[model samples]
Structures are given as C-alpha cells and as structure tokens.
Target: MSFSPDRSQASEAAPVTGSAPGSASGAFAIATQGLSKRFGNRTAVDGLTIGIPAGTIAGFVGPNGAGKTTTIRLLLGLVRPNAGSATILGHPLTASPSYLPRVGALIEAPAFYPSLSGRTNLEVLARLGGYPTSRVSELLEVVELSDRARDRVGTYSLGMKQRLGVAMALLPDPDLLILDEPANGLDPLGIIGIRDLLRRVREQGKTILLSSHLLGELEQVTDWLIMLHQGKALTCGSTRDLLAQRGELVVEAGDAMQLDLVARIVSEADYVVTREDRTLHIACPATFAETLNRQAREAGATNLTIRVKEASLEQLFLALVKGDRS
Candidate 1:
C-alpha cells in the first residue's frame, strides 16, 4: 500500500546517473539504512542495513518468520518502514515510480486469471501496466512457456504457473529482479530449469535478489548473502568471505583421555572446542590442522585422525543463527 507514488514530482527527481555498476563510486543496486517494520506487538524487520551490488546474484535467506518477506516488501516499497530509508538504483522509495519501471518482482505465489490462457493473461497484464504487447512472445520463450502459451492457467501445473509468473514479471524488461521462493514446490526438473533461467538472466548483466528455503539450490546461484534471524540482520557479506573466514578441524583420538587432553591443548591455543564422544571439533583456520595433529602426537594420543573440513553455506547459516541466539 505504501508503494503508491506522488505522481506529480516522482519523475522530477534528477535522472539517475553516475552510479552504474563498477563505476568508481562502487554504487549498489539496492541500499538500505536502518530499515525497520512492525505490526502490532511484533517487529518484523529491525534496523536492517545492507547493500546489494549490481550484476550479482544475492541470496536473501532466513528461517521461517525471520522477516525475509517483510524485508522484501519494504525494499519494493509495498510496505513503508517505521524508520530508516531505502533506495533502489539510487532512487528513494517515494520516487520509485521513476525507477521501479526498470525493476521486476515475483513475490510469494503470484495469481493469474485461471480461466485465461497463459499468453492471454500476460497480454492483459501488459495492457494494464502499459507495457508493449510485443514482449509477450519474447518472454514466454525466455521462461520456456512458449509451448504452453495457449494453455489455460487452470490447466497448468504449479511449475508452469510459476514460469508464467516469471514471464509476467519480465514484460517490462527490468534491470533488477526480486524473486521470493521462485523454487518453492518445484520438482527436481523444475528447480533445475529455474536455476538455469536465473543463470541466463545474470549473463544478460541483470542483478537479482533471490529468497528461498532451498539452501542447497540457493548456494548454487548466489555470490552474496544477507542472512536474517528474529527480524534482525545476523550477518551480511560476500558468500565466499563468510564461508572461508573459518573452518572446522575434526580430530578423533584413540581414547577418552586423549580426547580430553586434545581439547585442553586446543583450547589453550585459543581455539573453541566441541567434544562428541572421542571426537574433538575445533573451530579454527584450516592452516591450524598441522599444529593440532602435532600437539595430539606430543601428548601421546595415538590413532588420532585429524582432518580439516570446510563449512558449507548451510553450515555457516546454522552456525550464525545459533550463535546470535546464544
């Protein structure tokens, strides 16, 4: 509801310029300053500040009710923030009309006229949004809906409908895309199709903000991440930096006594240790694996198998969320 623009002066704001991706300014496609949202007794988004670089795929992730949807709504200007401000392509939300035309979005489950054919439905949307009807065929092909273009929405499967929704979003040829759960309820093939489609979009030099519960699939396409928990940003940075910042060293000794000694020595070396039976999990740099093995041997711990294990994105997300709760 808050996305409504002040039509009179919305387009009068200085035309967007000088902030293109890779410019010396290092401008962002999306930027927020202390954005927050609340409803009655609950705070949905709290003091969120993040920047999404242009021409990159950014994953917006969190557990259920972590304010992922609310944050997306706020970013799109559909919902106003209680405090703070956001800019898309360097234009304030109030001036969104000037830039939103260049943005596309498919939030949650988009609805279509079940009685209409996929192509007809898109044509209706094109007319309503004042987009060129010529894009209908082009987008249908882009989303792989061309073969089913004449099929009624009611006869289409969930995956087909999702594809049609994406086609609808692309009718305007947007520069940035905001997709929420695009892979939800999709079968393996459908999921793979969406992944490939996203990759193609990125190859076209478009920026994308994707949110989903499918962490594995998300990891395949995202280069940057903004993780949320309990309505707050737990951590935000490039995916590589966050995952490579630390790693786990798993050590399994021959006996309980050896494990205990290993934990003590590792802790003394400024590493956090977790013990599970005869295994010691130490949170440290991968480079420290040799030090750990040598220390175990010096302490007479035989049959000790020490190996370095890198944390995956899923592991990193769980660890960050749990750490914040603690």
Candidate 2:
C-alpha cells in the first residue's frame, strides 16, 4: 500500500527540484513549462505549461489532434521536446533517467499475448521490467482482475484488457500514473468501473494523470482539469472552479406554443436560448430565474417550471474551444 521509495539510493539522490519557473515548489506531482514539440513543419504541442498538484486525479482533455498524446509523450520522456521542459515526480524529465521507475504509464493500448492468461501476461512484463513477481498478484487484485487471472486474454472483453493494462502499469508500484484514453472504448458500466478504480487509486494517495475524450465521464472522476484546444491549453484549474463559472436556467412550459412565447420573452431580455421539446435552456445567471418566471407568466405560459442547471464539463469545454477559435 506504500509507494514511497527510499530517496537515499544514489539513483534517487536528486529528486526533481521545485525551482522550475512558474511552478509552485513542492506542490506538483507533474509540472511543465513552455513545453513544445514538433514533427517537421507541423507542431503538436505548443508552449504548453501545466502544474498537476500531488495526490489528485487530474484530467487531460481535448479534441482529436490536440496534441494530448504528444504532451503525454513529452512528460514520459518518450520523445524529446523541441522547446521547453517538464518535471515528473519532481525530477526533470531529461535529467533524471532513473526517475521512470517511479512512474507508471499506459500511453496507448498495451500489447499483450492473446494466447496467454492475464496473469501470465503480467508475469512476462514483470520479468522483462525486472519487477518483483509478487506484485503480479497484488496488482491483479487491485484492478479486480483476480477472478479472471487465469483466463486467456483473447477471451477477455475490451474492458478487461484495459484493466489488465492498468494492472501492468501498477506492476512497478509507481507513485505517478499516466493513463492515455483509459476509458476509450468502454460501455457505460465499464466507464463507471474505471472511474471507481481511479477513485480507489487516489485513495491510496497516488497521483494520476488521466487523458480521455469522454469529458462528461472524465468530469466525474477528476478534481483538477487541463483542457487543450489545438495543442494549447485553453483552461487549467479545479473542476468546480471551471464549471461554476457558467450557469443556466432551464424553463419548461406546458406546450410548444408556451415554449415559443417564453423563448421570445427570454430573447427580448438579450440572452441566448436553446430549446429541447417544451424546455428552454438558457445560459444566464440564476438571479434571472425569477425574471424569466415572471416573464413566462405574463406571456401566458402555463404549467411552467423553472430551475437552475449547472454547466456540464462538455458544455464548458465546447464553449471555450469555440470561443477561442472565434
């Protein structure tokens, strides 16, 4: 249950310094400054700076081709940065070649032998990585794969494979875990399962960097967020702080005609509205709810119900991205 390693070892002598510019010393599990990466004439990540504080589940989200993967690679030292630098577990990425052992990563779909049992696959990885064999069982239990430990990976579901991949990553008992698209192809139940798994990992005091396109689900599991648009950070802050920035009032009238009247009144008030059936969703302040109700009643909107709706992460992300492009 303990991930803290003895820092007295020579390989661990110089932990990542807290002296990086713009990063709060000793507050982050991962920190990057002006990080940039390029492929020939194309730029993938551009001046991306982020600070993920220690022991929190931080989400990395963006549209396709937004350089999320490249940024992850840069943090893992899988590729050299064209400009800028990063620190993982307090060790400068390029300087602390030995720091990788303290980190666990599943960058993409992990390859496993379909013919081998799940446990055997993990054993192979552990042996190759010089990880202790005792960890194989421990990780299997942690990922809830102990029941299927002896089953052939070929027979496992996509969710199972993803869970197995997580188990492999935990084989080293790393303090920092970086997962790219961990819930990429899961059903609703599978997504929730992974969410719960991540919660458990956080409870164990491990810092997790989860990258996924499923913003709604990602919102459920993360406390902090880093949203990328076109390889640049659109926003970075706590999940609640970002979502609470926007509020909406939802009004449902009795019928379509009532909705139309209500919409006209709200539009007259100079607020944007989106209609779904008999409900009008307005992105406005909560204080406007009373005014909307009064306007709806004055306009003869019967059976009207008004309530506040918090902006969802998807809504906020889309709005930010679109606003940036504009």
Instruction: Pick the lDDT winner.
Output: 2
Per-residue lDDT tens digits for candidate 1, residues 180-219, read: 9898899989989888888888888889899987778877
Give per-residue lDDT, candidate 1, residue 88. 88
- Candidate 2 has its poorest 10 consecutive residues by lDDT at 1-10
Q: What TM-score would candidate 1 get against the native?
A: 0.79
Model 1 Cα RMSD, 1 decimal: 11.4
TM-score of 2: 0.77
Pairs with backbone N, CA or C atoms under 3 Å apart (clashes), candidate 1 = none
Report how far residue 106 has shifted in candidate 2, in Å.
0.4
Q: For candidate 2, lDDT tens digit of each residue in 1-326?
A: 01111111112112121123363736888888889999998999988877888899999999898999999888888899999888888789887566799889998798899999999999999999999998898888888999999999999999999999999888888899999999989999889888988998889899999998879987899988888877888877667656544457777766788888888888998888998877788876445666677767776775777776666888888887777321
